[model samples]
Target chain A: MTLHAIDLSVSRGGVAVLEGLNFSLSPGTALVLRGPNGSGKTTLLRTVAGLQPPLAGRVEGGGEEIAYAAHADGLKAMLSVSENLSFWASVFGTGDIVAALRAFDLEALSDRLAGTLSAGQKRRLGLARLMVTGRAIWVLDEPTVSLDAASVELFAAAVRTHLGQGGSALIATHIDLGLDTELLDVTPFRAVWRASDPDEAFL
Target chain B: MIALLTRDLRLGVRAGGGFGLGLAFFLIVTVLVPFSIGPESALLARIAPGILWLGALLACLLSLDRILALDWEDGSLDLLATAPLPMEGIVSIKALAHWITTGLPLVLVAPALGVLLNLPGPGYLWVTASLLLGTPALSVIGTFGAALTVGIKRGGLLLSLLVLPLYVPTLIFGAEVARRGAAGLEVVTPLTMLAGITFGVIALLPFASAAVLRINLR
Candidate 1:
């Protein structure tokens, strides 16, 4: 499946941040979104993931089979690693969390509560959720935040494997993951602040 | 849906999930009511049904924020929104989990507390019956309130402000059923109205809640 965002415009707090943004992700490919903080990269990824609608334009091929991993891990601290993976796996109607655990190198910590894991371990658990989702397009925002060098490599390998299996990923990151992927800098699509608007008064 | 419900139930049972909080609040409020009003059996019995209803309502409210705030904070809502299940199903399951973990307990334990209130013998069954029929609405409607104020910081006050008015109808009909049953009057009318409210909210509020959650997610 090819995810397309054509002439997309996204807003934050009722103000347009990125405008006329166009992008597409073909199968077995990766797109790295690059922009400074507050540049609407997150907003754009969110729009493409269908979490929130775009102010204008539409995202084609996002109805189903798209998994979004926000900065937060979304893990239940009370649930162990395997339990958290199983919850998401069941939620996405996928089967077998063993591969996800092994892929993220979380097999050793499978029985430990998510709250008990270190920051990097928790992040791995979060990223492993993508594998359990069985989704074609993985929309990840700053997925490598707390990961160390080896863990980043683990995440990169997981993404590579996902792409090799004809899956696609849209990632926003400042660090290079050393992958054959396309880089999209959203700086060009930054929307100018419009001074005159009816809703501006409310702000 | 069952998976979500089970996960929520597990979370509620775990430490710091606020599962015990609502029940504890209900018990404390029920125990304090008689002390505040003085121990006159007639007065206590006369007002017991309403006090119990109020206590249940407030107790439900106490756990309302837990319905979505934790999910929202931990970013579970975002992932769940993108899951295969519809948003309506997600909110509905959350409401069901809340009702099971919070509302159902209050219903079961109300009779025990009714003794403390000197509730008339006839009032016991009616109170339980009314609560059994009514707390589902409280959970459903409170889910909407939680979704509505989910974006606000420290929105507990705002949440209560949004939900208390909605609870008025449920509270009135529910208390009326118990009060009428206690007085040996016909309980059919109020009981019917309470059932209507519960079924109506349970059937419709999930849509509104899902919509509000989508907006908040934006």
Candidate 2:
């Protein structure tokens, strides 16, 4: 499968966060999205994941299924980690979460409420959700935000393993995943403002 | 689709202590009003319609903030949005959950609250009927507001401000019908208008709520 984004632009609150962006990724490939904070790295990932609508272009050539892990961790504070995984697994029509949990080193925390986990643990649990999705394209936003060196290594290993098994990923990360991934710089797409059109004024 | 609905219903039922809390608050507000107003039965009778409407309105307001906040926080909203179900269907399911937890229970409990306001017998039916017609609109409107504010910090009060103005028609006809029933007058006009408002909102709100939620999620 190949994921293609053409002429993509996204604006938030009148400010264009991403503009005129284009990218393509093939199956079993990884793209490391690099940009400074607020450079629309996450927005670009979201557009690809179909979480955020593109202000201008469209994403094409991918199947309906895409797994996304946003920066928020998006966990249920009250539900146990196992419960969260089961819920997501059911959502994706994949009833298995044991392998994902084991891959993410979250088997022990599975019985604990997600709120009780450490920040890194929570991030891993969030990533574990992607496994159950079994999606062709993995859209990840800042997936390594809270991980220590070891967990980061574990995440890189998991990504490599995912790619080794012919999966594709579009990851927006500040740090390198230590994999042979393509690099896409998103700084060119940042908003540029002019005192012209009122609607486009929030550059 | 059934799975999504059942999941949200289960989560809402288990986490909906606030619904009970809202009813308790309504009971307390009704009980305190007469005592504060010098135990004047006549005054209570005159204000009963207003009081019940206000109670229902506030109770509706009490839970609007939670309609989408918990789902957004828990990542369930993401799963829901991406599920096989359409966005409109998801919004309807959520609104139905809101009605089941808060609106339905409020209608069932309103007759007792009506008694506290010294409402006459006919007024109880009016209150119940008005609530049944009006509260779904409340949930639908509030669902739109909740979606707008889902990811924003300090959004609860803002959501109230955005949604309350939209609630006026429901409130007006609901209170008017209740008052006419209390006066032993024909309430058919106001009742029909109230039902019209409910019908209109129910027909239109799911699309608006789903659209707004998609924007917010974006």
Candidate 3:
């Protein structure tokens, strides 16, 4: 499957942020989104993920195939690591979280409550949830937050394995994961504000 | 669908998850009313049906924020929206889960609470039956209200505000059925109206809730 965004314009709180942006990611490849703060990186990713509709253009082949992972880890504090993963697994209609558990080196902490894990560990568990999603396109927003170097490598390896198996990822991150991925700089697509527009005055 | 239901049920039962909180509130309301009324059996019996219905409605309202706020805070709602499941299915399952956790308990323990209020014998079956038919609508309507104010922080107050007006018809029919059944009056009219509201909301409000949720997600 290929995820394509054509002439996509997205807004944040009713103001245009990114306009006329275009990108495509085929199977077995990855696209890394690069931009500065308040540059609509999150907005663009969300638009493609179908969390919010596009202002003008439509996203092709991205809705059902996309599994979004935002800054929030989406883990239940009370459920154990395995239980949390299993619940998402069942939700995504997949079974056998053993591979997911082993991918993130979470087998040891499988029985522990998610709340008890360290920050990095919690982020790891959150990233581990993607493995159970079984979707082709991953729409991740700063997925490496709170991760140490080794854990970043773990995440990098997981993405590599996913890409090797014909999956794609559209990640918004600052640090490079040392993966063979394409970089799409969003600075050019920044929607310029006009003096005549009333909305831009408040912005 | 069952997976979501079971997960919510498990979360509700977990410590500090607010499972029994509504039931406890209902109990307190039922128990406190008599003390204020001076233990007069006649007045208590006369008011038991209305009191129980109001108690159930408030208890359901109290827990309304829990339906989607937790998931919204943790970004589970976003992910669930992107999942293969339809938004309608997600909201329906959520309402079903809330009914099971909060509304179902209030129904079961309502009769027991009625005993404390000196409720007449016939009121037990009618109250329970009315709650059984009515609480699902409460859950579904509360789901809509919760979805409406989900984006706002501290939305519980606004949720109640948006939901209580919608609850009027259900409350009227529900309380009427209970009151008339307690008095041994014919109840087919209010009973059917209660069922109508329940079925109508159950059939339609999920779409409205789903649409509101999508807008909130936006």
Second chain TM-score for model 2: 0.95
lDDT of 2 at A184: 90
Computed on C-alphas against the true complex, the DockQ of each candidate is 0.88, 0.37, 0.82
**What global local distance difference test value does model 1 have?**
0.93
Residue range A1-203, candidate 1, lDDT tens digits? 99998899998888899999888999999999999999999998888888887889889987796899999989899999999999999998888999999999999899999999999999999999999999999999999999999999999999999999999999999999999999999999999988768775464
Among the numbered candidates, top DockQ falls to: 1
Could you tell me which residue pairs clash in candidate 1?
none
Better of 2 and 3 by lDDT: 3
- Higher TM-score: candidate 2 or 3? 3
> Once superposed on the true structure, which residue ranges of model 3 sit more than 4 Å away at CA?
A195-203
**Native contacts kept, each candidate:** 0.87, 0.30, 0.72
Question: Model 1 segments beyond 4 Å from truth?
Answer: A200-203
Where does model 2 sit among the CAPRI classes?
Answer: acceptable
Per-residue accuracy of model 1 over B110-189 as CA lDDT, tens digit each: 99999999999999999999999999999999999999999888999999999999999999999999999888789999
Residue B50, candidate 3: alpha-carbon lDDT: 99
TM-score of every candidate relative to the true structure: 0.98, 0.87, 0.97
The deviation in Å at residue A7 for candidate 2 is 4.4
Predicted candidate 3 versus true structure: per-residue lDDT over B57-111, tens digit per residue: 9999999999999999988898889888899999999999999999999999999
* Rank ordering of all candidates by lDDT, starting from the highest: 3, 1, 2
lDDT of model 1 at residue A162?
Answer: 97
- For candidate 2, give the DockQ: 0.37
